[model samples]
Target: MIDWLHPSVLLMLGMLPLIWLRGRARQIWQVTLPAIILGLITTLAAGSQLSLSFMGLELTPLRVDKLSLVFAYVIGIILIIGNIFALQVEDRAQHIAAGLYGASALGVVLAGDLVTLYVFWEIMMIASVWLIWRRKTPIAYEAGMRYLLVHALGGMLLFVGVIGYYLATGSVAFEKIDVDGWAFWLILIAFLINAAVPPLHAWLPDAYPEATVTGTVFLSALTTKTAVYTLMRGYPGLELLLWLGVAMTLYGVIYATLINDIRRLLSYHIISQVGYMVAGVGMGTALALNGTAAHAFTHILYKALLLMGAGAVLQMTGRSRMSDLGGLYRYMPMTFLLYMVGALSISAFPLFSGFVSKTMIVEAAAVDYRGVVYLLMLLAACGTFLSTGLKLPYFTFFGKDSGLRPKEPPINMQIAMGIAAALCFLIGIFPGALYAILPFPVDYNAYTLSHLLKELQLLFFVGLGFVVVIRYAGGKDYIALDVDWLYRGPGRRLVIHTRNMIAEANHDVRAEFMRFLAKLQTRLGKAHLDGSLLRTWATGSMALWTALVLALVLVLTLGT
Candidate 1:
């Protein structure tokens, strides 16, 4: 069964080229059909494993444990929904790239060995960049290049680390690991870069918002969450992740609050949101890891829904800045309502998906006596509401009429958002359905009098602050720098200065050597006139020496 399913899915990868065929129906089916087949393979492959030996290394191309299954299930669903959302896109390359990107994402999670994971990881990075480049904007192209460079750096780290680990352990299994040495640190840094952890995080916001609208939806779903999945498998309960996660949570919130463009705002929010999952991995408790997986599941759904909503407005109005959008609910009521569902869900409103999964991390923090971490997570929740929930929505949907009336997006887009919004709500109200596929058993409940009251009060106060933030915050479309400043600013200047200095030094050394060679040539050119005895009587002396040698040989023969 595993043998047939794995090859069948790989065969589906070949069908992406069919999207280049004429007719809208053919293109949509080209991508969607493959997505449906992969989904079916995921469902049918429960408790299955596929193994092979290549170059003396054992490989697990397909592993269907609970953890891998849950991720695969979500990946399959996202591919279909993302394809459906992209149905109206006529760019065949976008469709084909998105399809291949999804295939690689599924392979990444299902991989049971480091070699398999690395192959899929590289494919994923390569395939997703086309989505950004397909947009064909100066910003998108430049952003795509930066995105490739960052992920390439991460890939190099991961590759070297994998080689070193195999040398040390003599195995290639993908499982839990410790902070052994440079190899482990290299691998960990690679995962952290993908997870969008601070300092290594700027690539996400730099590149994600630059993708084509339909492409951004798929972009939001795949890469970073795949990193989270790898982290769960490789480095669970590593204590440093706790503070790193906390910093990411706050770092994203602060920057997101200041950002004006809707997509960029949400891009920073990705950094913030993934911080929760990273924090969960840090705690490394069964509950925390379960929550990490579950939250990643929900974040993908609601975040896609939110992006779909934003993309709808941008698609219709030709603008995405909050400063340029207002009172849109008058025309795009369906978009407004659908977008709100995502906003509420991400803000962790009661009976929403975030409410159910986000607290699992906080609860883990609390139980583990991480009081400081608990407070920071709570503040991040408030900031989540203030920025994404209240600020983004108010200015876009209801703050003030911007005098631009545009109709709703296409039906396919609405259907896509509806599917995603439905999943967000369904998982929130009934987390057990989502929990069932988790790697471990879950018995915790999210609703209690104290927990409910605290969440409400926290959001309520944040809502009040939003009233003030709107009056002053996000009123301008200005850029604010983050950790990216180190490289994009002083670090870039330093590189240029260092190159110039090396070039100048090379010029000096070459000139000095040329001068020395000229002097040596001058001395050799004058050697004939340097007053040597051989120069005075060269011809006469040569003949006399030859005659004397002959005469001496004759006299010696006579004496003998």
Candidate 2:
């Protein structure tokens, strides 16, 4: 029982106070108080691991394995940074939501069993949607509903898979299962949905951009990364992931390229980044799995930093679309610089965090001689460079001056972005610190002449392609369709059409029934009130009776 009171559990248990306080006050203390407690717990319990049994299963609610520790560490770090970013806002609701959100993510990563993991997984979903709804906009409300529905569906699928696994194997363990059955596929589908793989990715861009500035940063770090953690644990070497990952990569890039909204573009790129991690996990080698884990660790930092930078722009300017944003670098130089660091890292530029981590996955793929997979990954990298790394910063900060001058965000926001930016550079320059915590042995070198030259060449050519496309291309429209178009466009129209048909059919049926009733009523009124039909029947019956009696008398006399 004492073992269950590990750091994460203790911090989670402590969240009750913060949740209660949200109702009374909307202050920084409401959020920072919980975060302070959580950070202390994390620092004190860094090397300790704990577990307990529940329901005849040995459940480890707290497992400080190297893989788990890296993510746990990052979640803790992000929580602090996010709190700082949101310090100016007086809404304690967002604060409490962020705390629970961070705690739930940490719970999922540290869990050592399927049931335990599922418990935290569902909690994370609930907590995250609350953050989305904190925006208090009509769009935020609608997007939150869609977000909740999708995650609920994923949870149901995961629960079914867990039950099926228990019934088949008589064990509720969180280890890799043989992927040759219905149960494994069910679990895979659930994780894939959360990972935002292609078709199921509509919820992310739909909901994320609608969240509050600070809320989106928290949202960006957790949901998909947790899915990545699950994939690392449950479905390594699942061949289908390679194809799915590639599909997500291309799909995200294409959609991101066409988007006018800056934050939505970043949301799409999140799917793209997850694809790399998914593909790495599919490779299933120790190095590949480690790469996937490391990439996830770094991806969260850089992505959040980018989102934070974008959030600052939104907070200051009250605008998010690229079309409405331009040349703020002169006014918000620090933000622009910090955002550039994040962008470069994501683009896998040399001496950046992405260069060190993402290369491991690409290298793993190349070593495996997956020709098509490698080619597609390279193309996707180029596409990422085109859409997010180049397009986002270029359009938002460096493009033609739109003549808008907004002051820098509040000091806390700068501190948040500054911390994240520093971490991005630190991880890239000295990857050994990050690599030391990987689940496996660390021997892979991130920097080499050949690797650096190849990456630069790839990025260079991709940049050239972008310039050519922009210059020679006549149609430079800023709108691209995604999988959501199915639901929002044709699907919505079809629903409306079907509803109209049903309503028309109901009206026609009601009118026909009324007409029939009226006709019947007329006939009944004539028969009952006038009594003509009844009188005729009585006269006919009497005549027939008299004729029959006379005939009978004649026959009787003859017989006698």
Candidate 3:
């Protein structure tokens, strides 16, 4: 019998019925199912394990621990929010894709062994690309293709790494690996790719903006965060991640400032914010790891809120570029209000979720005595405020009047954002609620007077600079090229040229073979016509041969 109560199984099962259901039924099913999953996840006790045998190997597909539960609870909550946001969408496929994508991520979090994690990891990639494709635009299609290809590469590396690790050690348990050997490096690279670390990071901004308005909300929540969870589980304390994480924070903020599309701007910040979690994991201290988990949970809520606001703008105005949008706040007052909640939360403003969570990572750097890293992270925080907190909303909602008046999005959309916005505020006000579920005990306080003063000073100056240079700070309509240019430009041309060369060679070989066959046929026809090999003289020749063979047979018989 199937374990219908299994969290992943329940999620997948809920989605399969969506294909056949429609209208009110589908919406109800999708909404209620996630709530149910959330309830189930909360009830799961830590140290719970569900084991089975597969191919003579013991497999634990469900491993409930504090770490996995943290990811599970947040993922479950996001599923509800994303489903409610998408309630107005008639596309069942999109809902199914979002559900499966969340389920797969949850599966990875709960997986007890490397093989189980890899299985869910690959599924997560496959399910997510569809959200991008569901937009049904040419750019969306291309972006989806790129997203699929990058993750496929990551999946391949992960599969090979799993095999190598299994061979190196006679186990496939998913845990912190010793930082040495081909297996470790390969696995780490795979995780980094999914984590959107640097050059492997291009797929995120490339595809996220192209997804359907509602789809981007779910896209924003699950994939990269899941990779961060895996990093915390399997690769924490690897010092290399410390620097790489800081670099991502700066890299994302810079591009986010320059980007034109609203969703793209938000997408880049995903990289920037995830950098903090990555850096925390690298720190490997109890506080840092707790910060990573706390920030991840809070980031999901606030980031989803931010994306939902952007998606609403896109849905109502049918434009995502800040260059094409302005003065939307007058018409979208509620949207503007809720979006600011998220903005303040993400900006790490005092008395907000971001203030409570993001500071922990920065404080972790300080606690570790890494002054240089601390300063660089502080610099990235300034950029975050400049881009995501200031420039994005300013131009998108309050910049020069573009004379476009778009009303607020559907009620379901507002409710979704409300849920996320409320969570951001609640988490901010009640940090203890978030801290209680952390894998480690919490000892740090985020409400310190010194910390508050420091963050306030940083934001104040960043805001001042933006106001002084407001004209130059506005977004211009242009695609900023990133490292993806290598693949999307020259790399694409190389593939086309190689394909053309192969086609030419194939044509020549086929033509030559045809000519050879024709010549052989002609020669065979001539030989048959020139000799008595298969002609009308066969009767007389056959009779003579028969008589000679008869004489030889008689002589042989007599001799014998």
Candidate 4:
């Protein structure tokens, strides 16, 4: 019974006071309070493991295994760093929401049963919406509502799948179910939406950029990563993920390349990175899953780092569009350096975390899937380099210097970016530490002649393609469409049409009702006061009443 209380729950419960004290404390303390609670939860969860059963059902509510540990640890670290990044802000509501958001994510990763996972999953959705709402703009509000609706839809699908699974299999364990039926497919669809799989991925770019700068960092780290964790946990061997992953990879890269907004480009790249992890998970080999896990861990660090750098720029310049931001490298040297490290790491350059982690997934694809899957992944890798690795940093920091001379970000923001950048390099330089936490043993070396040559060839050719595109048609006046176009274009029109129809119908109904009432009043007035109808009715009623009384007496006697 005591074991079921789990250390994470206890730590979160402990945060209640600090959250209540948020109003009275300094901004730093308010942010740090959640960080402290998260750190304590991570520390306490380190070695403890327990499970229980109730009502004839086995309940593993707290499973601190390797896979869970890695994510829990990364999420905790990110939360603390995110706190530091957001420390200067004085919004107590954002502080509390961010704290609960991190706590809920931690709970989701650590949960051992489907029921518990679902509970935490919903909590994460609710808490994260608050982060977006913290932006406090009308656009942010609209984005948040859309984000909420999408996640609620996801929650509904997941709940239905859970119910079906329980009915079909009579168990609510979080383990993988057979992907042979509606239940499993429902669950997969739910996860796909959360993973920001294409067509359904607009919620990310729409919402994340709308968040306050600090809020975007935390937002970037948790939701999708939690989805990745669930994927690794529940659907590791699902083959459809391989192709779905490829689709997501290419979709993200193309859109990212076309995006003029800096943060939107990063948001697109998030989908791109998740695609790699998804591909790895789809491969389902020990090395592939390990790569998936490691990539996700490294990605959270680097992606958050990237967003932090962007956030710093936004904080200093109040601009997020790449066209509007450039050449700040002169004033923000430290941020530029940190941003470069993140970009390099993401590019999978030698001696970076991405090189160590992302390769395993690619290698697995090359070996296991072979043929088109491998080729597509290779192409996507190049796309990754073009869109994010080179494109993001080049345009923002080094491109033609947009003549903007903004001051460096606040000291704490720089520190946050620095921490993330350092970790990116450290992990790349030494892969063994990250590898040790992987769910499976890793035997592949990242730096081989064949691998390096192949990667360079792919990247170089892809770079040339980007150059050609830029020279030939990159500036052409054309809009690349996304699934959001359906809603933004057709769906929106349908809504407008429906509203107009309803308004017309309502107006007609109101007019008809008014006319009918008017006619009834006129009739009543005429009958009662302006005609002989009332007098004739009174005389007729008296004759009819006398006849009815005689008829009733006769019938009563006969019946008796």
Q: List model 1 lDDT by residue over 1-560, tens digit each.
A: 54446633563456555655767756557655756566566555567788899999999888778888777778778887888888888788887788778888888888889999999899899999999999899999988998999999999999999998898888888888653779899899999999999989999998888899999999999999999999999999988998899999999999998898999999999999999999999889999999899989999999999998999999999999989999999999999999988999989999899998998889989988889999999999999988888888889988889998999999989999999999988988898898888888997789888889999999998888877655687547788887777877998899899999999999999999989976766676687545443244677888999999999999999999
TM-score of 3: 0.93
Residue runs of model 4 more than 4 Å from their true location after superposition: 1-59, 456-480, 503-560
| Cα deviation of 477, candidate 1, in Å | 2.1
What overall lDDT, based on C-alpha atoms, would model 4 receive against the true structure?
A: 0.81
User: Which regions in candidate 3 have their CA more than 4 angstroms from the true location?
Assistant: 1-4, 529-560
TM-score on alpha carbons, each prediction: 0.88, 0.84, 0.93, 0.86
The residue-by-residue lDDT of candidate 4 on 160-237, one tens digit each, is 998888888888888776646898988888888889988778889778988989999989999999999999999887
TM-score of 4: 0.86
lDDT of 3 by residue, 181-232 (tens): 9999889999999999997999999999999999999899999999999999
Ranking by TM-score: 3, 1, 4, 2
Q: List the residue pairs that clash in candidate 4.
A: 352-428, 353-428
Please report how far candidate 3 places residue 525 from its true position, in Å. 1.5
In order of listing, the candidates' clash counts read 0, 0, 0, 2
- Compared with the true structure, what per-residue lDDT tens digits does model 2 show for residues 170-227? 8777778753578887888889889998888899999999999999999999999989
Candidate 1 wrong stretches, greater than 4 Å: 1-3, 7-14, 44-46, 497-560
Best by lDDT: 3
